[model samples]
Target: MDNTFARCEDLVFSYDDESRDVLCDVSLSFKRGEFTAVLGHNGCGKSTFAKHLNAILLPCGGSVYVDGIDTKDEERLYDIRQRVGMVFQNPDNQIVATIVEEDVAFALENLGVPPEEIRERVDEALKSVGMYKYRMHSPHQLSGGQKQRVAIAGIIAMRPECIVLDEPTAMLDPIGRREVLKTVKRLNREYGITIILITHYMEEAAMCGRVIVMDKGKVLLDDVPKEVFSKVELLKSVGLDVPQVTELVYELNKYGLGLDQHIITEEECTEALIKLLS
Candidate 1:
């Protein structure tokens, strides 16, 4: 199996001819079945970059390829979209049908999938997100988390090779956020879907296999969570916050406390502090 799933080469994007580049000479690759989190402040071009993956936005210069299909080619547009699915932040905006199962079936219906296959796909998608039992329920009656899971199920029913979520948890409460994140992680782990999560939440980013920190439309850091979060000052310089536990250890180290350099999680911080005392 090939490791590379998505590739961007010298990708430059701008909204209009008069506007400056939103993404400048950005080149990166995402591996298959890897969960990657993209972190950046608003207007820093993370979402713009994501839009290129599905050809919602094409590069003003350079190129983007999803599963090796060039996005600039009109002939491959449908195939490119089928290979990558996108889920946005708002559940209300995403939900199209009244019933959960119907909403999941919407995309399949558009694709002209046979009714029998649509039923099988919808049921499998709903079950994958733990929302199978709620298939008959009205989408409006569901909680934010449940609605978002239904939204995800809609994408899953398409059976895309990759799923790109642009702040899918932004509008949800803590519980809703957890539910969506868990469902996404499960999709990557159990179903082997490549996940590209664009989020402002540091905690959410921590759960990814790789973290890419963008600033002023360019990648400033790309590394594993520990390495990326370790540079407390660098993250702050880019108008981003470290995870609470990481910040705590960083402040403690500033006061001459000895904690391991790689602490990113609360569990790791607690264990390190306990060992230090012992």
Candidate 2:
């Protein structure tokens, strides 16, 4: 009956005694197969939260649990990490193997999976991310997005039930960003993998079903994307942006044109305006 795939109970973390908490009373939970976006300005402890997902950082107070396995339990550490894989910001930093397929197979190899199974899973992972054609090529030759996909493939081959990405698109150009984002979305939809994406891009956050906004180590908003992003003034006050389409609708409303303030995309904005005109 327990549907929560991840949970943080009154989580608190601090670097040192004199330093204030980087995360304070951060209690939250995510359902299995849900795609959730975590958004905040720089130094808001978003990354710090991501690290706690896979036990990269332990809570100084309270506790974090992955599938009911507490992260504070030393024995469950590996089990927790295997259940929730992490993909960091930089693809270059993650790619260990020179060749694409080799990189994809890296994690499986580390886990002592059979060589034949590794090959099969590696191929599937690479193809799932749309990088199978470059399987034999060196990762250094691939574009930023392709490399990021490869990094994801490596995680996919591990068959983790969830992925926690910390600004995976931050280092990519527009095209690369699109590729990585699309890939992650597909992974969530087609594979039923839980996704926790940390991003500053309002557009990217708009794509998620749920959004969590944090500031100064505390969660400020937790709701569906529409409700979370509709608070234009509050989001701005905390140094975050609403989606462009939401902003456009807000401006139109300010000028006395009634429009749906929750529109998250240009297509939705156009539809609302058309309906308003009719």
Candidate 3:
């Protein structure tokens, strides 16, 4: 049984006829419950490619499918969006209601879901993101991370099977970034929601199960994080970086230290160094 939750096939898109293609022959599939990170420099078409997952942007030359439904099927637009929700870079743009709980319930209310069910979902979503205590609090009063969590709660309340986050932590500080990332990872690990995270932060990508590197509107690399980060020189050539620890290991390997080139985490790098010294 194939487990593809979303897919793009030979996708080719451009802003207009005069402009260059933003995505060229981009074909990839997201598995049902995998945590995948997309990495690329600015203007590398990572964000544009993400929009294709949910029909936000249509392919001029190929197709995008979610749960086997083609995104171009206007009749299934609602179905596609419900299955694959989007969380953009700015949380402020997504939060609609003044109250945290109300913001979470906004989508359900719009869909005309029952009041009782709405209440249940609102509470559940907020609690999932660790923000139930602030349910009645004003969203404007919360910190950046809190607001982003609330925004995410809003999407989860709608019960999306997958989430496409386009640089969700870009505007956040380190603490805020950590808070959002933790919530995202938990949702994928605990609830089995497929995650497609488009980010430039090497550290953030390192935490994901799979990493895809994009350049010039095409996929340059796709593999497990350790495998993808192993190509430090190639990534650097395309204006991308591996995790800091991966880079350190790569540099040490250059000096014949015989460290692992695929070390992507601090713990692994530390262990490798300790073993070498011992």
lDDT tens string, model 1, 58-121? 9989999888889999999989998899999999999999988999999899989999999999
TM-score of 3: 0.98
Q: What TM-score, computed on C-alpha atoms, does each candidate reach?
A: 0.97, 0.97, 0.98
Which digits, one per residue and each the tens of the lDDT, describe model 3 over residues 1-28?
8898888899999997548988999999
Minimal lDDT window, size 10, model 3: 14-23
Q: Per-residue lDDT of 1-278 in model 2, one digit per residue for the tens?
A: 88999999999998776488999999999999999999999989999999999999999999999999999899988798888999999999999988889888887888899999988999899889999999999988999999999999988988899999999999999999999999999999999999999999999999899999999999999999999989999999999999878998988899888777788887898889888889
lDDT of each: 0.93, 0.92, 0.92
What's the C-alpha lDDT at position 19 in model 2? 85
Prediction 3 global C-alpha lDDT: 0.92
